[model samples]
Target: MLEIFPVYITPFEQERLIRVYLPKNYNKENKRYPVLYMHDGQNVFRDNDAIGGKSLELENYLDEIGLEVIVVGIDQNSEDRKNEYCPWVSGEYSKKILGYTSSEGGKGTEYIDFIVNELKPFIDNKYLTLKDRTAMAGISLGGLISTFAACRYPHIFTRVAAVSSAFYRNQEELEKLLKSSDLSSIEDFYLDCGTKEASGEALISKEFVASNNSIYEILREKISNVKFEIINDAEHNYFFFRERFPKILSFLVSAK
Candidate 1:
């Protein structure tokens, strides 16, 4: 089942669409299900709503696997992608991380606050959810924010996924933040990217993908349950992410 509603992001002073997915038997069953909060709501379910009309087909896949986790897809503001996705100042970050000129950013924390304090409460109140079985996952800058949320507020988001995160921008800041974070409450953490994204002179020079791999290693060393992966011949795109969605969900919706 699918439900769409408007969520007002108070920090950004904007309203966005939030798509919620429930199992077919949700109304009939009394069991509370685990929830996976995903970023880029538009690209999550329907191809009509995705970039290049490439939907994740998540519902079908979950059904095929007989998994019943609730999925909440949260939309993002495309115009301020860099600003809202960045958890730190862009200048202090690498210069060409955005594939363009340098930028001035650092509003990610504020964006996360809205998700944690506002949207979460709404979802929790509306759905029969397993409060302790909550996770946050996203792609690109969305991935960056998901990882940030996991680090900053593990009590609220116990599991996290940074799928092809935009790490090139704030590598140092991210490393410092994760190293200093309180992740005692986090249970499962997942970090991954396609081989194509990790390749090339741009991402292999100890700054982009290599550094991301290092971050995964660091997190795995520091945290109890962490998984890192590299997809063979995959690229940074919606189709690839859609294909990986099932595996990602499988990792997250474990014994909880």
Candidate 2:
């Protein structure tokens, strides 16, 4: 079953829609389940509500597989998405690669703080959740934030999946942070990037994949259970992300 409600984000000082997907037997049974918090709430489920008329179609997939886990999708602020998802301001190279004249970012710390400090507590109190068994997943910039959150709060997000992660902007900084932080609590991690993240630019696509690999290397050193995959022929979009969801979830579920 799916449920949508507005929740106040104290960091942003506004309420955004939170999409929750409960197990089919959530109401029928009295079992507590692990929760997976995802970014880009609108694009996590139904396609009709997605920005580009595409979504992960996660609801159908989870229901079809009978995965008894809770999913919480936090909507993004379209205008401030870059800032909220990036822990530091975009670097010069990032702007050059993305063709942006201005700079945006540096608010991610506050955003993640809201999730760990306020929103998570609210969700745990309202639902029958296995508070200790929490995970986080996201795509693109969303993936970037998920990785940052894991490094920042490893105890809270034990399992993390970062698909088609765009880490060009803060690659060096994130690598440093991940190395310095204590990631002993992280149980499972899934990181991947497509061979063709950018259409028609082989060099750029290779660089994108390489950047993700750099982070994967750091994670492998700290995390006991980590999976890094280079998806062949995949692109950076919901379609490809949806295609890889099963593998991502499977690893998260089975990895010991």
Q: What are the C-alpha RMSDs, in order, of all predicted structures?
A: 2.1, 1.4
Residue-pair clashes per prediction, in order, are 0, 0
Candidate 1 overall lDDT versus native: 0.81
Candidate 2 C-alpha lDDT tens digits along 1-256? 8999999988788999999999888999988998999999999989998989999898999899988789999999999999999999887657656767447889999999999999899999999999999999989998899999998999999999998999887776788899899999999999999999997888889889988999999999999988888989898888888887987877765524
Q: Which RMSD does model 1 reach against the true structure? A: 2.1
lDDT of 1 by residue, 1-256 (tens): 8899998899888899999999888899899999999988888888888867887878677666768889999876778777888888754446655455565569989988988899888999999998878899888778888888888888978888888887767777888888988788888888887777644644543345675686897788677999888777767788788877778888888884
Instruction: Estimate TM-scores for all models.
Output: 0.92, 0.96
| Candidate 2, position 244, lDDT | 78
User: Looking at model 1, which ten-residue stretch has the lowest summed lDDT?
Assistant: 198-207
The numbered model that scores best in lDDT is 2
Runs with alpha carbons beyond 4 Å of true place in candidate 2: 92-96, 99-102
* Whole-model lDDT values for every prediction: 0.81, 0.89
Give lDDT: candidate 1, residue 201: 44
* Stretches of model 1 off by over 4 angstroms after superposition: 91-93, 96-101, 198-207
Best by TM-score: 2
